[model samples]
Target: MSEKEQPRLASGLAQKVVDTIAPTIDRHVNIMNAHGIIIASSDAARIGTLHEGSVEAIRRNQIIRVAQADDTAGTQPGVNLPLILNERLCGAVGVTGAPHEVEPLADLIALTVQLLFTQEREHSRSARRAAEARDIISALLAGHVAADVIERTLDAHGLRAPLQLELWLPRSEQDPLLEQPALDGARTCWVGLFGAHWRLRKASDEPAADAPNANDRYLIGPAAEDAGELLAQAEAMRTLAGRPAMLPRRELEGIWNQDIAVAVARTPARSLKYLAARAQVLNQEQARTLLVVAAASSMSEAAESLHIHRNTLVQRLERIGQVTGADIRQAAESLRLQHAVYARIALDELQVF
Candidate 1:
């Protein structure tokens, strides 16, 4: 950790400790930082002031006792005990009474301060590790880092892979279930909030034993060497979520490659933005009719699916061609129109508007 980022016993916590300790011990108590500046004290005037006896206690890593007769600048008649956390001097605690009388109370308060500091440091370290883990996952999925680099980075964070990635989108932003850990039995798992969704990656030999509940949508990507492919599968899953024909319990694995319609849907919005814009010329009914025609086996089947006469379907198709400047009768033109429909769906799912 950087020097500036190193955790310290916060002043508020120090004050609370002083308040707790003061009731039991008749002596006034003060908490001082490493620099000997008083952070919290039972005597309010002492706060923000330097305590010379506490400075000496920290510098010597031992107790310093001052007498009233030997008063010096910033010195008080009390016992100062250095607060040590993990073998390092973090601060000091001072008790305002005769040296022999308050020495034990000062020692007890110092121990409490050390314990609190250790706990705070551990919590800080855990938070920093979680943030680093999320950054690595995001970079890998975005294809900004190569596999070799990711391997090294993960190792540096003490994370190993053979990892599984799961994408989840909760129905509500404040869902409490999102607080649950991703995989209970994995060696180590990292869950992060990515905009409107959550991304979970775990290092495990096999899949998670349990799945998330129905209140949230999830797509579990297969274990693979390339994370970019998993990202593409997530994109395809999002596109499918917006489709009317998508089943509630559909398996999303391999949908990007095994299904031609989904494969076309996976096309990046930037690549099909022009066609999506041109598609805007048609109304919602015309667009729906076009998608039905492209999906159905025959013109009559398409009309029946849309609950319209074949002639009406024919006229709508002709009008769609005129608006988008594409002949829906030709095979290639029909495929392009289908791709445009998927692109629109993908863009909408992405919230590109």
Candidate 2:
């Protein structure tokens, strides 16, 4: 690993390594710091003393074997190997036994130590990046972070621009997506919790956006181009929850129109409630008639779609007006009346105005 990313081989970590491998082998194990002093040993009495074989192995950056006749003070006849990670020498490990018998065990122990160190480094890096991503997302939503600042931060973290964000509400607490690992440089997307909802941000070109499936667990918001747009979409989705009539149908998508109808999506809840209340008094037949009339080019065309006689459709419209307190025939009131109908279909009656 690079110097900045290298993990320290503290006494605790050294002791852990000795404890793990010593049990699997009959030989005594010793983990030494880069300075050649034993930091951890299966034989605790040898701690803090220099191992001659370990010093030689570290100096040469290779395995060194001390024979029975050649063994010196503060050392035993054993095999020692240098611990190298990402081309950098970190420390050494020594196994006490005949040189030939302990060489293989020493090699295995060295590899294990390097793997543990590598894992620790990666875990640290992932945590640091996650914190950075949360901060960037929070600042962007708050409007405190500039576009240039976002661009620079993303570049530094290996994330690209021209990103699209999706908002999703989990249908249950056991969602599998919640278990996904944190974002890293290798990933093109990141999932995070923002406020009371979850936001998934990914590269715009990663995949095509599809209409939400009726059986899906999440109620997804439209892909937003920026944090401001995302906020508005989130608001609309939350307000429309538990009222399926306001959402898009599987065969005919209507909710997607919010992309162009930004004003409707951003409508204040009080105004929406008032508009919705106008249609709340209508029965199912009257509500359906009003929706058809609002979408139809002419009253006759609406009658044709509903499979009802033209005169019958007119009578239904009159009844709808009487109950809704708004006339659908007036051009000026039609738009507001239609919005009111949509608001009515999308919001729950139990919700306070």
Instruction: Report every candidate's CA lDDT.
Output: 0.65, 0.64
Cα lDDT tens digits, model 1, 296-329, are 7788988887789999988898899999998888
The ten-residue window of minimal lDDT in model 1 covers 247-256
Compared with the true structure, what per-residue lDDT tens digits does model 2 show for residues 1-353? 35665546878777888898899897899998887999999989989988777788889988888887443365578888898875678689899888889989988988888788778777766667567766655555555556666666756766553345444444444666544454544332234444223344554444434423444323445445554554444455544433433444433332234432344445676777765666678766675676667667788998987899999998988887787667678866666665665676555442111
The TM-score measured for candidate 2 stands at 0.69
Off by over 4 Å in 1: 1-26, 35-39, 42-50, 65-69, 72-75, 99-108, 115-119, 126-130, 140-156, 170-177, 180-196, 207-211, 214-216, 226-353
Clashing pairs in 1: none
Q: What lDDT score is found at residue 328 in candidate 2?
A: 72
State every prediction's TM-score relative to the real structure. 0.54, 0.69
Mark the regions of model 2 whose C-alpha exceeds 4 Å error after superposition: 1-10, 44-49, 69-72, 182-202, 205-254, 259-271, 281-338, 350-353
lDDT against true structure, model 1? 0.65
Best by TM-score: 2
